[model samples]
Target: MCGIVGYIGKREIKRQLIEGLRELEYRGYDSAGIAVMQNGKIQSFKAVGKLSNLDEKTKNFETEGPGVGIGHTRWATHGKPTELNAHPHMGEYSYVVHNGIIENYREIKAMLEADGVTFLSQTDTEVIVHLFEKEIERHSDLFSAFKATIDQLDGAYAVLLITQKAPDTIFFARKGSPMIIGRNRQGEVFFASSDAPLIGEAEEVAYMEDGTIGYATPDLIHSEPDALQFVSLSGDKLTAQKGGYRFFMEKEIYEQYQVMGDTMIGRVLDDDIVFEELGKTFLEGISRIKLCACGTSYHAALTSSYLFERQAKMPVNVEIASEFRYKEPLLTSDTLFIVISQSGETADTLEALKMAKKAGLKTLAICNVDNSSIVRLADATILTRAGIEKGVASTKAFATQVMVLWMLSIFFAKKRATLDNHTVKEELRFMSYVPKVLQKALDVHEKCKRLSKRYLHGHGFFFIGRDIFFPLALEGALKLKEISYLHAEGYPAGEMKHGPIALADAELFTIALMPKTLLYEKTKSNVEELSARDSTILSISPEMFELADDFILTHPHKHPMLEFFEMMVVEQLLAMEISIRLGNDVDMPRNLAKSVTVE
Candidate 1:
């Protein structure tokens, strides 16, 4: 995903455009550019690699006059992340910044080239601007031309256009990609890929729905009222201050306690779990659960299998969404296919949900975005309410998804009469204190940081656990390798001797999940095998301190099912701290994008 911003207001927008680009950089930072219509022509400046490069190019540029402008920070898709392929690509009359692909770009490009229209860059976005230029020639009105242009394009997109013919207006349209429009009391209007840039600047924001077209000017923004649903965003979230934390990742890691609490609110009542959107009848007659997801969401699904099997006494199957369809799963009336995604627009997950729906099986979605594609496709939906997860390595979203799964498991247990009222109350009470218990984990932040430093320079890392904790170990390994660029592997503690133990040595670091349970001795024996090879041991348990080279004590969970929640937070912090110590880009890791929209 790329970040795009547009400003059409009473004030000069050069500085605002730069500031907005910086705020939205988490979406992408491969290249940055800005365009303003000046003297009936487009004034465009672009550079490759980060907003800083564009800032350097515009250092001596003038912004004395008020102007409507649009800017982009790109995560390249159709072309390389070079200056030639940056956004704000111009045509005869328009300069445009675009997010999302044009599936038929080649067909459109070929038709335009046959007409002798010159193309500037190797981007599908350039094709869009040229098509818009052609549309204006016949339509004669900017709004008509913009709408006509969007009608011809296929695939997902959020487009912002500024043209010489309409120098004072900024026009935009979206289909299957996120876009927001905001307006202030002074009549200034702002547009961004997300609400990050509009937080403090605009008084009210309207999240644009798919297939909507709008335009903004210094005095007003014009669009169909029903196409958007406005929401109030806090100004405090827009501030650049990191709340005294070294990085946004660090700040977000700590925000988990609060956000996870938010996810639980109104949903978990006294001694009961409730999803207002789904009634008790929703889970009735469900013989099996098929969970489809990818990456972090898939690990959450893996953990859900344990909860559903043990607590709900139901059979649960987890599949990577990308492979689920290929396997040609046998779907029946009693099967409930659940799709989990933070963005809900994840392509493979969406496709898997579609396949399940086509087979006449019931579908459910666990997602953060209420209006996302997967939510729209599902028969029932549960919102994570984790808020916007900006960091590439997800923290709050994962915590909230697991929490929802546990609650769902309890709900199923109740329906099947497998869980007694006493057990339900105990689990509910445990869920209620999750936020406080997670905060207690943060109390040992310095210990995780210290442990990070000691193991930051290790040659490799090993993460091993059992049952529900096994998936958590996979998640921990993922966080470390993704953020820190470390070579890490995760395995079931019992399976370590099958093959992974051969890789153990003093040069490696082992993080063992040895929670005090029936299998604690087996996990401890796995740690002993690692220690025999002189590997440094990092234990994540209330006990097992004697077996660890460095141990971060986990606050005891009255219910064993809740232990993984605290373990996940500690792993997230350790990954962040290690990445920081290595001088790595903790938020936007190398060659990684936050949302994987493309296949």
Candidate 2:
């Protein structure tokens, strides 16, 4: 994913665009550039590597008068990360910055090349400007040319274009990617990939819906009235501050205690689970649930499947959203299609939700973003309330998703009379103490930090667990691999002997999750089998294992879910500490973006 920012205002353009790009640094980028309309001409600056480099390049460049500009921080997709391949690609007439893939760019590039248009950069985004230049030759109107160019494109894009023909106007469009338009009291307009950059800068904001083509000027934004739903931004503040922590990952790991509470605040009341977003008859005809997601959200879906099947006695199927559409899945009327995404703009998951809707199935979205694409498409949505997750490797979002799903499982069980009144009340009471349990889990930070030092040089890692812990292990391995750049695999404990045990050796590190409440002894035997092969074992449980090379003791709890939450904290902290000790970028890991807006 890449980040795009544009401004049409009276303020100085360079500094404002640079600051907006800085706020979007978490989206991950290797090169950045900006193009501004100054003195009736487009002036551009380009830099390779980090927003700081772009800031340095633009420091001495001065511009005056009311200006309009578009800036981009690019994550390499079509070409290598070089200054030539950076955004703000210029044609003979227009300068453009874009996010998301243009699937048919190769065909378009070929046509432009045959027409004698010279290409300056090896980027799909370069095609946009060239195409616009061609269209403007056909139609004198700037907006008409922009619209014509967009009509010929295929695949996801959030594009911003500025032309000398209209020096005070910025033209933009959204397909599968996200774009937001905001304005201050002074009639200055702002555009960004997310609300993070515009939170305090704009007094009101509106999300640019998919298939929207609009233009903005300093005085007003031009779009169909029904297409733009603006919201006042008086009380909403950006929550991305790291506070006292070294990184957003670490701060988010610690914020789990508070965010978990935030997720459950209105939903849990008087030993009853209430989801007001889901109407009274929301579950009336739902017999089975098909959970679809990708990456970290998929792992969360897997974790919740256990609760939904065991606690609610509901049949569930989990599908990787990227693969769900290709296989032509069978959709039933009684099946409730549930999709999970942190940003709610994940391309595959959103596509899967659309497929489910077309098949006439009830749809629900579990997401962190309020007005995201998936949220709007689904029949109902449950917000994760994790605030803004700045880290590319997710921590708090997973915790809140599992918390919400766990409560939903109990709510279903109570409604179906599968669990009696007393058991439901007890489950709710135990949930009330989860915030404190999460806090106690944070106490193991120093132990995890010390253990990370010993783990830096391992050949690889195997995160192993049983039943519900299997999904937790998958999440643990993903976190480690995402930030540490280490090779890691997650496997069910019993399945290790089938083939994976051959890789276990003294150089291999096995992080074993052995909860006391369920399958502990069986999982312990599996750990011992790996230890016999000389694998370095790091066991996490309420009780110590004598065979473990290292141990992190969790407090014993009456329920397995409590131990699950506690071990989750341990897994997250261990991954963050190891990545930190390796001197890696824990927040913005290499080749990863906070949101996956492109497939």
Candidate 3:
């Protein structure tokens, strides 16, 4: 996914835009650019590589203000990440920055080229600017041009545009892909692809709703009636000043405390976890539920499958998005589809969602980014409030999604009379206290750092667990392989004899996710199976800590329904620590992009 940021104020637009881009560096981009409308003319600068290239290029420009601006960090999908293909695309008449793939833009581009529009770049973003130039000739107002342009669009997109005619205004629209509006101390309004760019610059934040358009200014804004009403805000003074952390990822990893707080913020009231009004019809309408996801989200859904079946007495199927769409799946109108994606722009997941909708099934999406394609297409949505997961290896987002799934499961289970009221009350209370438990793991970070070398050279390591922890094993292996250069396998502890046991040897290091639950002692005994293979075992549990090569402990009061997510978090943190220790660029791993946008 690409990143977009905009500012309309007297403050130096170039400085603010670049500063914001630095904050959002984790979104993963190949090229970066910015455009400011000064003196009724657009001045633009873009670089093919890192944002630093733009920094070097812009060194000659004075930071003058009294202008409107828009900037972009691009992840190439339609074209190579070259200078000619970078964003902040100008169409002789307009400058635009966009986030999602425009599914049918090639066709639209061919039509635009026929109009004598000299194309400068090979990008779907360029097509929109060209189309808008034509649309603007007919309707000059930014709002009207944006409304008409959106009507002609074919796929997921969040667009922020500025033109010579309306240089003071930014026509921001979202059909899909996330875009948010924020307000600053001077009542200045800011818009970005995500909140990371606006966090310390703007205080009051409102996630833009789907099918909504907004006209923004330093001190003015108007949006669709359904959007969040304008609110005033100021940045956190402490974070605004560098906290001496070496990297944003490091600062963010440490910010887990606030992320946990924000997730539970106001959403819990009087010991009850009401999910700030997610329409329950998403849960109630599921005569049957199919959870579709990719990567870490897939593992989270796998865990949810066990929870739904056990706690809600509901039959749930978890399918990887890439495999789900092509495989012959038995479908029915009564089926409910649930999609989980951190960015909500994952191409395969988006396509799978479309297929499910074509089958006439009602759909619900659980996503961290509001206004993403999955969110727009879904009949309903429950948003996880973990703001801007910059780390390519997801930590908080995965945990929060599982937390939401757990809550949703109990909510529906109680609605169907499958769970008792006492059970619901206890899980809610337990989830609220998990932040303190998570903080305990930070004390063990150094141990995890020391534990990396054993896995770095590891020919193969095994992750073994049963029941809910089975998915935890799968997720742990995935995180390790994705961010770290290691060979790993995840298997149900009961399936060791089927084949995995033969691969086990003294050099093999096995990590078992043990918890104090119905399967506690059984899971502990399974550890012996690995130990018998002369494997060095590492166990993470709250129930028992036996003498092994390694052990990580959780607090004593583990929440029955919520423990799965906490352990998943532990493994994710461990995996990242190991990945960083191996000299891998933990945020951007090799042969992989954050979102598999190109099928």
Candidate 4:
């Protein structure tokens, strides 16, 4: 997930572009660059690393003439995170900053090379500017060349172009990634990847839908009327402040108790769950579900698979979005396709959603972003009220996704009469306790922090559980591996004997999830087997296991879902603490960005 900021305004070009890039740096910070029109020429400055580096490079530089420029904070995809591979990539006549991958860039680069074009950098984005230069030679008109170049590309992108031929305007196009255009009463136009950078800068904003190509000048903004989705930014502010926490991940882990309430606020009625967003005819004739997602969203989907089947009596199939399209699986009208993503701009999940729509299957999206590509493309959407999840590992988003999906299962059960009204009401009552359960879960934070030291040195981590807890175990392993740079795996407790148990030893640390409400004895017996193998067991449960080397006791809950929430907090805090103790970036992990906008 790279950040894009472009301005055609009355403000100082260098300061405005750099400040905007600073606001959007959380999207990416591997490298940063800016390009502005100065003295009838395209002036560019680039630096590797954070926005601070770019700011330092441009400290003595100033811009003259009309205020028009484009800037980028890159999360490298096609090339290494070096100055040569940073954004604001230039061709003979155009400079471009791009987010998302161009799948067919190699073919187009080959074609451009054969036509005597020299490339300066090894980036998929460099092909865009070169292609634009080639198309400008053929079309002559700037907008025509922009669309012509866009038409030739074969993958996801949100591109901002500044050309010497048309220095007064900033031409842009969005295919799969996110881009927003904003303007104020002073006739200043702003473009950013999200509303974060444009919040205080512009009075109103419009999200550019997929397949949209347009341009923004100081005095005017133009796009196809039907493609512009405008919203007034009267009081919208970036709410991703860390407050008093050391990192956004820490703050987000503690936010679950509050935001989870936001997810269920209006939906949880006295005795029924309602999704007002899903109109009367939304779930009609749905016979089965195919859930597609990647990474932690995949684990959330896997967790929901159990809920949909056990509670709603609905058959479910969960697939990793990256692998879903390659399998050539059957897609049918009776099967409702659901995709989950925290950013909603995940490349694989978005592509999977498109493929399902192409096959004519009714699609639903569970996402946090309001109008992301997947949310815009899906037939229906359940927006997770997790707000903005700034952490790359995702703590609140996963909890909210599973929370919403759990509610969806109950809603389905009530609608289909799969569960009696009393049972449905009981489920609703349990759902209401989630916020409190999450608060109690946070009580284990100190314990998790204290235990983090013991987990620092280990051969590898094994997070094991059974049934629904199995998915939670997988999520725990993912969190540990994500920020701590540790090798970890999650497995069904019973499957440990089959292949995984061979590595069990004193150095192997096992994090066992044993919720008393569901299959606790079976999972405990499995943990005991690992303990017998001389594995150091870290038991997370309401009851203390005597065979464990360490124990992080959780509050016992009436419902298994409540225990799941409790264990989730334990897992998240433990991972964060371990990462912190190891001197790793808690919020922004290496080799990873907050959003996976490219494959």
Candidate 5:
């Protein structure tokens, strides 16, 4: 994924474009560039690093007239990360900045080369500008020529173009990727890949629907009908400023306490859990439950399997969504399929939900986005209410998903009479106190910062736990590898001797989750086995302080679910602090997109 920002106004375009690109660099930061019109001529500048590189290169440019420009921060899809491959590609008539991939660029490049059109860079974006040049020569109107150029292209794209003939106008089109047009009070129009760049710059913003084309000038804008309607930029999104924190991940890590409160607002009452989204007859004749997801969502589902099976006494099956569709599953009318996704647009999970519906099985979706495709397609839906998760490595979404799964498990347990009235009351009491325990966990930031420094030079890392916490260990390893770019593995405590024990050595650092539950002794024994092999140990526990080489002390809790939730917060902070210390981008990891819409 790449980031694109454009502006058409009377202010200095270079300053605004550079400032907006700084806010949008999380989408991509391989390179940065911008193109502005000055004195009836188009000028372009690009650099082969972060946005800071482009800012330095354009510090001396004169951008004082009725300036209009477009900028980009590329993730490098078709070419290597070089200055020549950066965006704002120039042609005979226009300069363009594009976001998505063009699948048919090779064919168009061959045709353009045969017609004596010289290419300057190795990017698919260059073909778009040159193709528009050819179309403009044939058509008289600029809008007609832009539409004709879009008709010839294949694949997902959010393109922004500015021509010498129409320097005051910014033309754009969107198919699959995201783009939002924002309007300021001064009749200035801004466009970007997301609302992050437009948060403080504009008060009103509109999203471009699929297969839409439009243009914006200082005075007017016209496009497909109803495509120009605007909404307030501040729409209860979780993109607030980092209140005294150094990074967004740090602020989000501490926000886990408030997120638990938000997720349980009206659902968790004094005694029973009420999910009004699913009716009383929604669970009728559901003999078995099938959970499908991918990556971090799949780990959440794995944690759900333990809850549904033990508490609700339900037969639960968890499968990776990408692998679930390939196998011919034996489905029945009694099978209740459940899909989990934060974005609600994960391609594999959406496809899996479609297949389940086609087999005559009832479907339910748990997602963060309310109007996403998966939420609309399912028979019933439960919104996570986690708000917008900006970081590529998920933090709040995972916590909210676990809370929802607990509510679902308790509801099923009460319905089946597996948990009595007194047990339900006790569980609810423990759940209510989770917010306080999470606050105590956030206070351990300095201790985790100290512990994380020791493992920066570790050759490899291992995480091991038992029962419900086994999935939490998997999530910790996933977060570390996603942001820190380190090699890590998570396994069940008993399975360490089966295969992973061979890799334990002085070079390996193992983090053990011993939460003092029923399987505490078994997990503690696994830690001893690693210690025998000369592996460094960091034992995370409430009371077992001297059992390992290092200790991350947590507050003691008798409830297993509360202890697991507390440990999840600690692991999130651990991964973030380690990545921060190692000088890696914790919020936006390399080569990872927040939403996997393209599969």
Candidate 6:
């Protein structure tokens, strides 16, 4: 849930770490810190609040650092996100930084305290440096000290260690969290939580497998896996972060076109779609389908349920993984469970998948992260090719997952005879039109900015829709409330009178997720009802709903089957715009981390 950067090269390390921290801010953090071993000492600096605080603190200092270093932007699972808890924890001689939970830290701390290792902070991370110092006395070498310290660390972690004794080397290790190493032809080696730091300097990378350790030296990256064999290495990009965009979200939004292009690269056919990985027998044996996910992934599931129900004629249950696990769902032996997670390591979703496996159900995981625990455990997995999404609020990953589910539904429908081969082919043909449509959506930036400023203060926003589009309404309101600091609610179009009509007064801003579909009549009537109550109407439809006398906006038009993707993009954009208009941090929202790794 945090971002880490470490370097042991002949270049300045603070700039590399600060640049990487910008990408990692979406993971969530209240503070940032960095430690550099230069001039025979470990120099450390930390600041409370965004990475900017740390940047300001170090701007006047000599940043011409050519030494070993480590930096961190925190997510605060162990303690409050304060300068004291921010990483790059230092001891008498060693400095260390880490990500993921150190579950056995207290026991280790008591043991160290008995040895006269004084405590400085209330963080589980601090113990790693103290332990490293203790181990250094026994081993005397940096690599041996790292090995001893890690052997005693019995929880999830991605650690980077350095000291004055080894000013030209950086020792790193990982068990559960992600870490990667990049090396250049000149022998410059660097390490990071991801390959975000070596964008322009070293695009060559070898993503470290779980339980792997890396020692970064000026000349080479020495990688050792705790388990077995060597892995393939490749130089991906000169800069692996966001290309040249100001924000990861903007770059990711634009990459939707590339992501979708790659996803649809070769599977299209004249009359049907085929998944190269899923064997025909897998579909042949399945009956009903269950889609499990959480948050944005869950919203994608709801959209996919419609595709399966209509195009495939399959009874699909789109259930929230947290709620679904408790229900102990009525599953058949032939039921095919499809779980979606961007990280492929969602805690509740992974647990729910385990229960499905125990019930003897065939399972398929749709994930972005390749070969993750969820992917390894599933019977099979459909890998969505969207790359790393650093923003706390997901963008490209959500769009790509929805596209995969839609394509899967189309393929399943053709096999099940719910839709003719010609119909499925036509749907795939229409999907090629998404990129241009999304570009048009991005053009309305000024309009969204104005909307957020004008209606930013609505006491409660009510979004209305009918049928499956109702979930889009709920999801839009959810995103808005999450980052925009607005109280919002979504209701089925026909359910306005059941209980929500009482709050549909002039003070409320209501948005209708209506498209030119069968439920248009029901959605139109809801707009009329809101108009009668004098509520501010913001209708989201391909064509404006005339009944609502409020400002009108028409999202990019798509075939009824593809309209929800367009709708989702609109809401996501609006939520982000509104968050910024209100002066709230868009990337790092309050009380939220991009990934909920811990309970």
Poorest 10 consecutive residues of model 6 by lDDT?
A: 227-236
Give RMSD to native, each candidate: 15.0, 16.7, 13.5, 16.0, 16.8, 15.8
Report the candidate with higher lDDT, 2 versus 6.
2
TM-score of model 2 vs. true structure: 0.62
Task: Flag the better candidate by lDDT, 2 or 3.
Answer: 2
Minimum summed lDDT over a 10-residue window in model 5 is located at: 235-244
Q: State the TM-score for model 1.
A: 0.63
Query: What do the candidate models score in CA lDDT, each in turn?
Result: 0.82, 0.88, 0.76, 0.86, 0.85, 0.76
- Rank the models by lDDT, top first: 2, 4, 5, 1, 3, 6
Q: What's model 1's overall lDDT? A: 0.82
With candidate 3 superimposed using the best TM-score fit, by how many Å does residue 478's alpha carbon deviate from the native?
A: 0.9
Candidate 5: stretches off by over 4 Å: 1-240
Q: How does each model score on TM-score? A: 0.63, 0.62, 0.62, 0.63, 0.62, 0.61
Candidate 3 per-residue lDDT, tens place, 1-599, comes to 47889988888889889888877676557789999887788899999778899999999886576888899988765555788888899888788898776766778888888988888887878988889888877885767877888788776678998988876888888865778888867767788876667776776877787788768765567787475765544445334322334334455556565456545544544445555345655555566679999998998898888878887887888999999878988878767788999888998899989998888888888887655678778777776656566567777787778777877777667767786778777777777776666665566667777776676664687888898788889888888888887888888988887788887776788888887874887877778777877788888877555646788776555565446655665686688878777777876778976556767
- Stretches off by above 4 angstroms in model 1 are 1-241
lDDT of 3 at 290: 90
- Show pairs that collide, candidate 4: none
Q: Residues 419-510, candidate 2, lDDT per residue (tens digit)?
A: 98889999998898898999999999999999899999968999999998999999999999999999999999999999999998999999
Where model 2 places Cα greater than 4 Å from the true spot, the runs are: 1-240
Clashing pairs in 6: 26-392, 199-238, 199-239, 204-235
- For model 5, how does the per-residue alpha-carbon lDDT over 1-599 read when each residue is reduced to its tens digit? 47899998888999889988887754435688999986568989999877778878988886776868999988655665788889999998689999766767889999999999999998888999999999988998999999999999986789999999886899999986678899988888999987777887888988898888988888988877455778887732235244346677777778777667656755676898877688889889997899999999999999999999988999999999999989988888898899999999999999999999999999999888655799889998887766557788998889989889988999889988899999988888888888788888887789889888888986888988999989999999999999999998888988999988999888898989989865888888888988999988988898764648888888888898888988898888899889999999888899999999875
Weakest ten-residue segment in model 1 by summed lDDT: 235-244
Pick by lDDT: 5 or 6, better one: 5
Model 3: residues with Cα > 4 Å off, grouped in runs: 1-250, 280-285, 543-547
Candidate 6: tens digits of C-alpha lDDT, residues 263-320: 5544554455757668878876788999999998898898789878888888988889
Task: State the lDDT at 6 in candidate 3.
Answer: 92
